[model samples]
Target: MAVTCDLSAERFVDRWSDYVGAPPLTCGIVDVGERTRPTVSGVDPDRVRTVSDPGNLQHLHDAVETHLSELPDADRTVVYLDTVNALLDHVPIPSVTGFLDRLTSSLSALGAVSCASFETGERGERTIRPVTETFGTVFELGRLGRSLEPTDDQLSSDDVFEVLSSRSQRLVLRSLLRAEGTLHVRELAQRIAAAQTTEQPDIEQIVTRLHHIDLPKLRETGLVAVEDRVVSATEVVTEVEPYLALAHPDERN
Candidate 1:
């Protein structure tokens, strides 16, 4: 199961479509946010946790802990908290840092993967300092698809179809699919790089292909459009999904 704090489920999928093909129970997404948005049709509603109060850090922290406890000690759990900017609007910067300190350490103890976003600013910097100091890997996102910095937690999946059908498209496509709003070519490159490899990958090369090639291929299928470096997935992506479902090895568990 996945736990998302302050991030919309649709936005998460638009940013990471591979979850669509993850193992049965493993693909669940628990949304801890202030309101409910439209659910992605192919997505299971039961997996989403819609909390009304997003400002409560302790409540959010406790909710995340409970979800983590339900998984096995070795299971690869992915906890994604959207931009810390929203939380900073309500919670103190130090409190947010302390909460992340405990939260990340707890996730590390479980051997789970976790990542979150932070706006770039003086306050954003202070809040993210402790987080960056603790997490070995951290980076900024660019756009072609969208800006999504996902951890490796849910990177493992059994179905290996649809979302994983095209090696050339997986990372780029998933990032576009999960975008909650406007997406750009540069930000997409950053998100894809962070998701697929640890070593620094060529951001320029990836952006070139998305702008000149992949985005056009996706456009041909009416899944997305790229004009002036801004990319948006068509409604077609969601409608054509049910037919592409792949059998997951763990579903038989």
Candidate 2:
């Protein structure tokens, strides 16, 4: 006899939601591409203690150490490290292996599952080695740019600003946007540090400035809804698509 199970995405989300609410712990996100946006929706906004750019393994390691304090003693924490299109340039085998070893040691100490997803390509082969050696589950997310889909989950304040504002602000916004919703100033700072790349400017001061000034400007414009450290995007796609088109006309197909 065959058996049926409710394993649809909605059912998975519902079950995951219940788990998040009952026992809280720190969950880490090592987002390496624009794909950072979707992983943000996987956990409760309140429970996400650390979100870092996996591009910098050292920073990723440090963030995990700091946030491990927030997890429950017995409840297992999980780390979702995503390195899709982000590591296509030079392959660093030693650094990658070292980071994975450290990450494995940390997660094992806490009794957590360290899940890593890599996009399939020559790069994926280079990237997945460390993750597969350390973590139990590894998923291949096909080629980059071909299957990029943003979740219908409400846009975070950071994502809205990214799609609407200038480049510098957009960088700052992407990290914050990926958080379940709003985030504390310190949390945003850590994320900015982790997500920093050569092309992006230093965001420490800008993050501070947002609390005092720019956030209000965005709120006044109805682009963002701010209540303390929490920020939500109020503007829908229709309002932002034109701006996006102006900024990135090449994205038009």
Candidate 3:
């Protein structure tokens, strides 16, 4: 079952087909909104259930719950929520998050795979930060592909400067570049402190800061990736590396 907030059921199926190949014949679309939009030619009308108002969360939940109760193979089912951004316009973050938490819990108990999409932007990011904690796994898909790596045209000079402004961040990029793009947090922290000529580096403190601040900023900019206490540099870091010196000219001398 899929709950679509941003696009019509047919459009969502079209995107799903494009991304993951043709959706199953058993696929169900719980489209949220009116039927003013024309349906696609090939999509099945019986498979789609629409709630006229996007703000009608109860109706949407009832639609999905009714669908779930009828499913014979719960394990084969996949629940998709194509976006939370549109819903946020109608409901508060807490309500949307609460609904998601409940839905995901129910889906998990049924052995169903749950997937959701949330757009990224200043406002979207604020909502996603908290919502992300609800899901067990999160995948970030860029405009091009699964890689969060931004293309040259996507990143401007100021964007690069903003990311590389911190001395610790610059050092991190340099170290990752030298290490062939991957290092454990402890090793990465040691390398960072070593570059600063710290004789007695507090490794734990450095690691804590990286976990909380530096790594997240770099990951957000697509300059690096952090997973399981390991940090890896992305192509963006290598591409904008020369500008690192210019970002902090004092570091050069």
Candidate 4:
């Protein structure tokens, strides 16, 4: 099940479709801030519920409860809630946190996975501190790899050598930097393959190597962020840029 307040239902599916996969039974979505229920792909229209009034917490809870009632296999189910930022516009911070606490506790009892998103700021932190106490794990999204302040401590010299050791990895970082630090794995492969080989770069082979080999190395070193097959460059890339040239076969020690 998905509950969207700031995020559109369609966009949520797009981002999470890979992980969400197909459920054994019918699923549902409660979209707040939409006047009419929008068509969501791979879902029955009847299952898509909408609330025009963002302040209607009861309606939101009822919609979620209705969906929970439909699916019996709680262990395999996932409940996703988008942006707490939008929900706060209508509900007070205390009420919002209380709602999340109750919602997560209920899902926990059923053994279903519960996840939610929140923006970054003083308000977000204040709300999330209480919310995090309810949820088991928290992921810092939107800016994991990209730090506003680039520092040398984020990446070690050994990590630098290892990540830039590969021609493909070097190509990956250069390409990502040029693309403004983010690209899907396939697109990143296409760009690198096209650069290294004049003949049509074997995209599948390149993609496989990146997945199994190059990307992990870069990701481990904090030089890149890999999520749902999307690779993003962290600010650490700026520190490593100069060394990429010296790591070339001709310049290597």
Candidate 5:
């Protein structure tokens, strides 16, 4: 089952279409937010439910209870909950923590794994300490390695796909991956524009876009680092390298 907190089902599918398309999910999707019904059209889930009042924890509990009661016996199931941090918007930190405790416990009893995400700065370090301690595992994003090579701490397929969603970001990543070391922002911009097949690549426009959009995104995803006037790829680029190849099977890596 997919439990969307602040995220919509359409956005989720956009990021995980590769997994959702294959092995077609004969599953359920729960939309929990302002919208009382499914926000994305053309996706009629077999068993779907929605909890519109995000501020009402009781409403959320009731929705999950209905879902749990309807689910058939299975050895394994997974619950994906995006925007765990968004709960903080409606409830107190202690309340949200308690809610997660009960939810995770319920999933565990059902033999289902709970995969949740939390945005940084939604809660302070002190507030987050107990919350992080509750989870079995936690992943701290944005720490980059020296080289753009695969590592034990590789990103998940979901993370990789999310990063690849933006074409401009992908262009920046590929440029960084090919470079031996740091590349000046201007040099990187020229290459990206050149790849667009423009006879006169606009260096100024490309620089502006990278500075305002692409570079910030790459940094947020930990795919690349921007320092001074230069950029460099990180270990994440290597993890995504395979997917890029699959995306363009005709081209050699």
Candidate 6:
């Protein structure tokens, strides 16, 4: 059985680089459906590859296989299968379950491991439950987002201090920095709440504190800003990109 894990692209790439004793590996983002694919800026254009219409399982498998083949034996490969939810949308519960069964089997055959991160409304939670129960690992990226750090080189002592000064602030900052944007506090809270597998104190209160207090301090440092209820990272690429490039370089290219 393969180990399944969920992490943001930053954390995943960082760990893979460490595990292989290599610089950062490039990633390819494939849109498995026919829609406007979301864009992730600052990601190297040369490093990214894409596949359209992965709704067809054979096409999905072939794309993944070809991508994996291109990597050096020592390099780790990650397939960001966006819209696992979108893929299942409108399908009957039993049909969705059957699809996952086949998808996992196919992935295993390709020597690839797969994991998914998604939001859960009560209705979505019902469908997600069985998938988690069956899969050995289920990670909540929003909750886990709080604990993640950019590669050491990517962050400075001031950055660490700024983040650690307040727990509420830290959580907000970490989430925005990871996503490369400001987010509504309510959304941030929901994400953090989900990532936490264990029960906790009032999450709403926590978010309130972050919005009132922590966010102000972060803004003073020019690390974050808020317009209305939304908060976004400030000058993140200027602060972290060089360090990321240094920490994870492409040897082949």
Candidate 6, residues 1-253: lDDT per residue as tens digits?
1111223334444556679776344555443444443343434543333445434555555555555565544134444454455545645666656656666665666666665555554456677786555443445445445233565434555675655654455556556656667678788776556544458757877687777777777776667778888877877434532233232122101
Q: Give one digit per residue, the lDDT tens place, for model 2 in 1-253.
A: 0000112222334445688663223333322322223323554544333323435667657766665556565235655444423432333666666777887777778776565545444545555565455543333344453222444544455555554665544433454445634666666666655645556646667577777765666565555666767666554433443344444423221
lDDT for 114 in candidate 6 is 64
Candidate 2 whole-model C-alpha lDDT, 0 to 1: 0.49
lDDT of 3 by residue, 1-253 (tens): 7787788877877877899787656767787876764464455566667788877777777788777767669888988888888888888988888878888877778788788888766476667778886875556556775643455535556667777677888888878877889999999998888877568878888899899989988888888888888898887674566566455534443
The residue pairs in collision within model 5 are none
How would the candidate models be sorted by lDDT, starting from the highest?
3, 4, 5, 1, 6, 2
User: Which of 5 and 6 is the better model by lDDT?
Assistant: 5
lDDT of 4: 0.76
Question: What TM-score fits each model?
Answer: 0.47, 0.35, 0.54, 0.52, 0.52, 0.37
lDDT of each structure? 0.62, 0.49, 0.76, 0.76, 0.71, 0.53
Better of 4 and 6 by lDDT: 4
| Quality of model 6 by C-alpha lDDT | 0.53
- Global fold similarity of model 3 (TM-score): 0.54
Residue 236 in model 3: lDDT: 66
Stretches of candidate 4 exceeding 4 Å from the true structure: 15-26, 122-125, 142-253
Question: Residue-wise lDDT of candidate 5 within 121-209, one digit each (tens)?
Answer: 54689777877766765665554523334356766556677777867777777777667646899999877887775688788999999
lDDT of 3 at 4: 77
Worst 10 residues of 1 by lDDT: 244-253
RMSD of each: 15.3, 21.0, 12.5, 15.4, 15.7, 16.1
Question: Which ranges in model 5 have alpha carbons more than 4 Å from their true place?
Answer: 18-24, 39-46, 143-253
Tens digit per residue, CA lDDT, model 1, 162-210: 3446644555555665575348889988877676544888889888877
